[model samples]
Target chain A: DAGVTQSPTHLIKTRGQQVTLRCSPKSGHDTVSWYQQALGQGPQFIFQYYEEEERQRGNFPDRFSGHQFPNYSSELNVNALLLGDSALYLCASSWDRGDEQYFGPGTRLTVT
Target chain B: QKEVEQDPGPLSVPEGAIVSLNCTYSNSAFQYFMWYRQYSRKGPELLMYTYSSGNKEDGRFTAQVDKSSKYISLFIRDSQPSDSATYLCAMRERSGSARQLTFGSGTQLTVLP
Candidate 1:
């Protein structure tokens, strides 16, 4: 069985540009969540998607958005990126009602 | 103050030693606790999960949660070089539908051979 997978292992974007990252949740999972981890810091929650809709969000600004497809894959889009937007973007998957979640390898976004 | 607090330790120890990592939280509503191990530049890998206050052990790793004190801990027995990684403690409220996790700064462990 395949676990959660993410595309574009690494990326480099200029300031004020936009970047899109993709994620495919683990098999048999339905919910997808996004997180941002800065160097030497723990991951901070971005948002969560369930049933193809964003269910909950964190303290991040509106520049960050996400989508969950019917197949349980997810995409995280960041607009007008700043240098602070550079970090490792992680995707986690779990059951809609289950408590535990599994994560993917993550996409490293570098806003230069 | 932040909701969760953890000592970001660059803890170094010799092989075969027991390692203990801990985190404290101010939110009493958080009912699900987790411990994740992350390698450099990698996403977190779930090591253990606990629903409520209690102790759960798996192989060389053990997790403990104390709801009254709002503290959680992860213990590694007979640590090895391969166990060296950043250990993160995460928790979330039980009532939420999305259940987004709040994480600590992570403790970096280096088990020297």
Candidate 2:
């Protein structure tokens, strides 16, 4: 089966702009989670979505938001981006909350 | 200090040597432990996972969790150059809809041939 798929392998944006990245979960998966990986740092959880509703959110500000579609696809939106926002954004998918998750290639965003 | 602490080593070792990677966490509430491997410019891939203070082995990879000491480790036996990558430790307090994970800075393992 195809693994989790993310769109626009790379992205570039300027400060104060908005950007949207998309992810499609692996087949037969229902839960999706987003993570941000900064240079030389481990990924930090941004949020999780289940049943098209956001189930959990991390310490990110209001500018970082997400949505899950009925088809198990997800979209991560960042508003008013900062240079610090330049990082790799990863999306993970799992069948249920208790199972291991599968991650996608991630979208590398460079905010200049 | 960070909740999870790890040495971001660009550790180098012989291809056939045994490799040990570790992480320590300050939160005793963490109940599940996992190891993830990531190649450069890629997202991390799950390697092994454990729920209790014990060892779980899969092939040449073994994950050990020591709840009492708030420590966990990943061991790679008969390591290959293919195993050269970054190893990250992750954990969660519990399971459910709120299954958010905390991650540690990855250690870069370089298995030289």
Candidate 3:
């Protein structure tokens, strides 16, 4: 079975610009969650999408948003990127709300 | 203080040596504890998981949780060079719906040949 997959292994964006990262959950998975891992730091929760709607969110601001499609793929959209937004964006998926999540390779976002 | 605290160790040890990694959390509500291993430029891969407290072992990995002390540990026996990676500790509270995980700064472990 294919594991979680993310697009654009790496990306560079300018300040005040927006970027969208894509994710395809592992086969047979239904829920997708996004996380941000800064340099030498563990990942911080961003938000989660289930049933095509946001199920839960972390301490992130409104600029961070996500969507889950019918096929269980997800997209994380960050608007008005800041230098601090430069980090590894990771996508995790689980079969259900309480299941163990599997992560993707992650997209490295650099804000220049 | 942060919810979870872990030593960011660039700890090095010879192959075939036993390695112990640990993390402490201030949140008493967290019931599920997990350890993840991440290689360079890669996302974390789950290594071990324990709920509440006690021990669970799988192959060379043994995970222990002490809810009373709010500390968790992951132990690897006869570690190999391939086991050298950043180990992250993550946990969450019991909930009916999806819950965001709180993680600690990962500890970088290197197993030298």
Candidate 4:
């Protein structure tokens, strides 16, 4: 079974550019969450999507937003990206709130 | 202080030796703890999880949580080189955002073959 899938394994963009990252959750899971992992750091929570709506969010700025589709896949969009936005964007999926979340190979975004 | 603090050790140990990794937290409300291992260019994979204050063992791995001391540990027995990766500690409160996880800077472990 596929654990989780993320698109554009790697991406490169300049400052002020906009980026959209994709994710497909594991089979039988409905919740999708996004995280940002900076170099030499742990993953930081961004927000979580459940039932096509954002149920919870972290300390991230308004620049980060997300959407959950009917099929449980999700997308993370970042606008007016800054140099600090460059990091590995990770997506995780679980059955419900606070369950064991499985992750996918993240999308590495580099801003120049 | 950050909610969770972990040492980023490029900890090196020989194969078949036991390895210990640990983390401390300032959030007393956190009741769930998890350990994840990530290889280069890959997302973290869950290795073990413990709830509140207790110990849980699975095969070659054991997770111990001491709520009194606000510290947690993961012990790996009979380590293998395949176990060489970055280990992250994540914890969350009971009623907070799902995985409102406070993650620690991971520790890079190398099991020499």
Candidate 5:
């Protein structure tokens, strides 16, 4: 009955650097989505992965990418990080695009 | 204009008081509405969700949606200190395969003992 879990509670990166954050979806869930929450703001959708392929994406630039594994785990990668990339990266999982989503503790990315 | 709009209220109230939080959206296609409670440095936890338009209640929490007005509300009765957190409103269209949600800026509530 474990819920969604994310790795590396926090991370620090610099400009032109790349980082990868990991997520393990809740048990019995198959779809994984990523979001970015800046300080004092609500989370913005980054992208969603279903069937090991990216199914939907938000207004984010190409620097952001994600992958979903056969086991329903996910990873979010950001390349050429900028100072603005500093934010909380959250991972959410649902079942077959279910109405409800469960989120993980999130990885705090600090771009220095 | 943003798809969803909410007041980022650092609303402070005495314990046992009733608290009300609201959000308005510009998108009529959004059919699924949700309220999430987020503690500092933590991911949001879903509080309530409503499909279409109606009222749903769970314990001290009540959620109301007015589709015609494109507004949604969350009411807390007999609030406690544990209820103090940032409340976020999120919604999504029903027709999408991905069903990505659009979220509000979140309202921060503090229930003083």
Candidate 6:
């Protein structure tokens, strides 16, 4: 089966601009979650999407949002990007809540 | 203090050596512990997982959790060059709904041939 997949392996954005990253969960998966991994750091949870609605969120601000579609694909949007927003955005999917998550290759976002 | 703390080691070891990686957490509510291996420029891949405490082994990987001490460990036997990567420790609390995982800074390992 195909594993999780993400689009635009890399991206570049300037301050005050917005960017969207896409993800397709592994086949037979239903929930999608997003994470941000800064340089020399582990990934921090952003938010999670289930049933086309946000199920849970982490410590992130309102500027970080996400959507889950009927097909179980997901998109993460970050608005008013700051230089600190530059990091590897990772997408993870699981069959259900409280299950092991599988991660995608991630999209590297660079805020210039 | 951070929920979880791990040593970010650029630890170097010779091939065929046994490698031990570990992490400590301050949250007692975290019941599920996991270890993920991530290569440079790639997302993390789940390597081992354990519920509550005790040990689970998969091939060369053995994951151990000590709930009493709030500590978790990953042991790799006969390590190879391919085993070199950043090992991340993640945990989440048991809940009926989805919960966000808290991760550690990850330890980088280099198995030299």
Best by TM-score: 5
Q: Compose the digit string of candidate 3's lDDT tens values, residues A45-96.
A: 9988989999888889999998888998999999999999999999999988
Write one digit per residue (lDDT tens) for candidate 4, span B1-113.
88899999999999999999999999888888999999988999999978868889999999999999999999999999999999999988887556667799999999999
Regions of model 4 farther than 4 Å from truth = none
Which has the better DockQ: candidate 1, or candidate 3? 1
Assess each model's interface with DockQ, reporting 2 decimals per model. Answer: 0.93, 0.82, 0.84, 0.77, 0.91, 0.88
- TM-score of model 4 relative to the true fold? 0.97
TM-score of chain A of 5: 0.98
- For model 5, the docking class works out as high
lDDT of 3 by residue, B52-91 (tens): 6899999999999999999999999999999999999999
What TM-score describes the B chain of model 3?
A: 0.97
- Model 1 chain B is weakest, by summed lDDT over 10 consecutive residues, at B91-100
For model 6, residues A1-112, the per-residue Cα lDDT tens digits are 9999999999999999999999999998999999999999999989889999998888899999988889999999999999999999999999883479999999999999
- Please give the TM-score that candidate 1 achieves against the real structure: 0.98
Ten-residue region with minimum lDDT total, candidate 6 chain A: A93-102
Clashing pairs in model 3, backbone N/Cα/C closer than 3 A: none
Q: Tell me how far the alpha carbon of residue B102 in candidate 1 is from the true structure, in angstroms, after superposition.
A: 0.5
| Predicted complex 4: CAPRI docking category | medium
Docking category for candidate 1? high
Name the candidate, 1 or 4, with the larger DockQ value: 1
* Chain B TM-scores of the candidates: 0.98, 0.97, 0.97, 0.96, 0.98, 0.97
When summed lDDT is taken over every stretch of 10 residues in candidate 2 chain B, the lowest stretch is: B92-101
Error of 5 at A21 (Å): 0.2
The reply for model 6, stretches above 4 Å from the true place, is none
Whose TM-score is higher: candidate 1's or candidate 4's?
Answer: 1
Error of 2 at B55 (Å): 0.8
Worst 10 residues of 3 chain B by lDDT: B92-101
- What overall lDDT goes with each candidate model? 0.95, 0.93, 0.93, 0.93, 0.95, 0.94
Tens digit per residue, CA lDDT, model 2, B1-113: 99999999989999999999999999888998889999999978999988989899999999998899998999999999999999999998874566778999999999999
TM-score of every candidate: 0.98, 0.98, 0.98, 0.97, 0.99, 0.98
